[model samples]
Target: MEGTRYLDSEFRFNSGRLSLDLAATVRRRASTPIDVLGNPNACGRWLKAAGLFSDVPELSAENEEALIRLREAIWKLVTGAMETRYPEDATAVVNAAARFPLGTPQLQSRSGTVSVVSDDPFATAMSTIARDAIELVSGSLRLRLKTCDQPDCRMLFVDTSPSGQRRWCSMQRCGSRAKGHAFRQRHELSVRA
Candidate 1:
């Protein structure tokens, strides 16, 4: 439901990339300029200030760098999607912060309204970790991900199954129709035989 806004038939084959999409959705949702590369600093800072990263120095530094790259990749994908550009993937984004988990050790806020007085390093770390998690989900579900075999209906979807043999984004929609037509052809052949 949250991602219903962006997940269309055009991106149906990306059901495995839903986790990545979710983060994109959130980033876009919180975004102001609306441009793909509007203001990475402002957006990145906002996420960090919002308690999304960790306060540790070494970990936060690594995450910050990864987050910047991830944002750049995401922006490229968004621009590509809008311009009908395909082939670009989300692997870079997923693997960037994949080394570290986002939310570890439950953090608490004892002060007034949980504000990081000095430079909020933790928030930055958390943001990248969040992006990494989405990437992991994308990788895990990549096998099930499918681009509709139909030339016309090239939608994407997660082919959740034991056999990993799903052929269409929706059988009731495209699969059933293809089957019906095939059955009719077979019946006609039988009669001719």
Candidate 2:
């Protein structure tokens, strides 16, 4: 806490879905935003992590720009869906992206491993994410989408937990910190009393 600042070197995949994970690349959009997908390589890393491709796909600056544009549109659509207000532009972007062809999963008999390959990996990844978003919004899981309760987090997530009472994006970070803060405030109030 003294000197080491939090670096945005790695991609975050905690949102539980491809589109949501992509949406999480840029954090705190309302205030100071931290963009984890700062470049094509980062985007490729995230796609690889998402299991979109067996190997990391080559991405260009244009790909990065397109990805960022789609990510923002996805964020808008997701938040709008959460509020029961789907933006026209966002809807169009996601719908168009979803229409793109997805990667074909081939079962390699040599290794018996399924690898998703595509003539255009970028298009495949983008379409896959957009399709996931579409399904998430149109399906029953839309009711479970929730933003993190931590004031500074500004993260969106699905409340898949039993009882559907999940709040923080990460219990170890936001939930624990919030609980500790409340405990400290309560203890201080008791001391004052």
Candidate 3:
């Protein structure tokens, strides 16, 4: 969530309509609205809407068992951005995304036996962005990015700040909180003296 600010609005459709949809899904991590969709939840919805798993009825069966796993994998990838050890392998990344509400994902079998494989179905949907997330955490990926320092806010944002010293997710929201706190502290100190 904290790294989403690094994304570009123009990128929503940059690679075309589908890519734009994915970008929009990824960008939801930065929104603070009542319907703010987190990375995990959005990933699930995207997979179904994108019809990536339609061929396998079991994949979308019984309350979206497969979708849940996919969402968890995505969450891990986003949360891992703040960690010292970025996931090096696809398994690690997939595991991270599968942390949300998940279940046994039954993949279609060529032999007529649906089975769950370590290879996450959602990972295929995420293949487009996993490398970018890894590169970002490893410092190999660079963009005009910044993280909001607001204690209650974990949103990531693009630094459109003129000085690029912006620390809050948005000056209109988190910025006011920081300023109000600083003002209170200054008043308390003056009163003590």
Candidate 4:
């Protein structure tokens, strides 16, 4: 609600994986964290911007609470998976979230071609995210999950690069800041010498 800054374009869809993106809804996980999902409206907007829903759904306060719970569960599960350990209650939470109804794939004809489209935006968004979390933790992609190396920014991401050596949430954001900080420190040290 108050921290609308997180809903800005800069914070949307940078993570290569949707589940990682969801985990990143909270900024600065290590310190001075900001909860981006400050309200149900914010959560609905995030879902829409994430492309999980074509339009923002009307979420109740209970839905907001459930989403926040799921978000924390996802974060714990992912971080634990990275360390080859499962966080206590993480599996149960994820399994419970997965039990939510999922979107039904409906075949529709558009321009004389039939294509499957997802119905029920709310269910689809939640179910897809839950499934993604399960897959990431239980599949080979678990090895690719990483937390940002930026000191104050501990966002999560999937290393999609060919080298799998990515360290920042975004090159233009955290990477540039880190590079500039290193350059300034070097300059200061040379001056002192």
Candidate 5:
């Protein structure tokens, strides 16, 4: 699908968590935001690209709406956890999502070797993301949650660095741009001085 190309190039998964990655589907949260999931096929493409599905699942309109609701719930939960005030509704939404039956991994033996494959990949992927959100919010990983520092960027990411001093969603992208902007400002100030 044409939408698949957009997802491949634009979707950022540097968040270290699927829930956060889903939240990043919307760009520029503080300003004019662009909902990357606006396209009907975008969700299916996203699931495939995220390694959540071996084959793209057909998503009806209702399914798309449900997915969007889940994504928003994840965003709200993460925001609340970051602010140290977990919203009860957001927590409930995440818990309900986790209650969905995840795909059963079945062992496949072939040529004297064994491999595992999920029976219901879509459900498994969504449930896994929900569970990960639960862990991130209530587990020790909560302290590592961080939103990108770039004014125009509103992606959330986990600081997995050894020192945990990371401030950008991606150093090669937002970080470099921020650093370059600062350098230019300093240079302009020096010229005036």
Candidate 6:
């Protein structure tokens, strides 16, 4: 699927990690959140977009619920970890989900196109995401984990820039808006001055 398809869907993979990206499937967690993964087809699209599946894998209700459970746990764990703590319940969920094996990629046909061959795509994807969350919460990257500073946006992203000073989810998205708003406010104040 085209990467730009995110503009048409509720999914955004810009969170900088598979696990955080999954957590972001539910937008605006602190406010009236939106569940973009509303159905099996949507979940499949997410898995495919995340590169966990080469195609839209058939998702079962049970697996979908499990996926949501893992996503929620990862969100809680990451947020709590930011405060130098990890919730015991969320940690347990992540630990259990991480036990599942990740999807295995295999070459297909003479085209040699590679695809994840998994008997249970949900389990495999969950494992991959859970492992990512585990690393983000416990490894050096935790120091770089940051939430967007935009007032209306609270997104968790890793500061992968060399200077490690990224503060917004996307400079084009939130930074530009905030800058313009600030500029407008300054102009108004200067007018009064």
| Ten residues in sequence with the least summed lDDT for candidate 6 | 1-10
Show model 1 residue runs off by greater than 4 Å: 1-138
Backbone-clash count (model 4): 1
The C-alpha RMSD in Å for every predicted model, in order, reads 11.3, 3.8, 12.1, 3.5, 2.5, 2.6
lDDT tens readout by residue for model 5, 1-193:
8956766686778889989999999988888899988976889878878777776789878767777888899999998899898888888877887887766555555555433356656666777888989999898889999999999886889999999999999999999999999999999999999
Error of model 1, residue 49, in angstroms: 28
Per residue, candidate 3 scores C-alpha lDDT tens digits across 79-168 of: 455444444453374545435332255756576756434355555544434444444445622244444577655455445556767686
Alpha carbon lDDT of residue 167, candidate 1? 87
Compared with the true structure, the alpha-carbon lDDT of candidate 4 equals 0.80
Best-to-worst ranking by TM-score:
2, 5, 6, 4, 3, 1
Ranking by lDDT: 6, 2, 5, 4, 1, 3
- What is the C-alpha lDDT profile of model 6 across 122-142, one tens digit per residue? 787888999999999999999
What Cα-based lDDT does every candidate model obtain? 0.46, 0.84, 0.46, 0.80, 0.84, 0.85
Which 10-residue window in model 1 sums to the lowest lDDT? 6-15
Candidate 3, residue 166: the lDDT equals 65
Question: For candidate 3, what is the TM-score?
Answer: 0.41
Off by over 4 Å in 6: 1-9, 107-109
lDDT of 1 at 13: 24
lDDT of 2 at 139: 88
Q: What is the Cα-based lDDT of residue 88 in candidate 1? A: 40
Residue pairs in clash, model 4: 1-38
What stretches of model 2 exceed 4 Å from their correct place?
1-9
Q: Which stretches of candidate 5 lie over 4 Å from their true place?
A: 1-7, 111-121
Give TM-scores for every candidate, taking all chains together and pairing residue i with residue i.
Answer: 0.36, 0.90, 0.41, 0.87, 0.90, 0.88
Model 4, residue 37: distance off in Å is 0.8
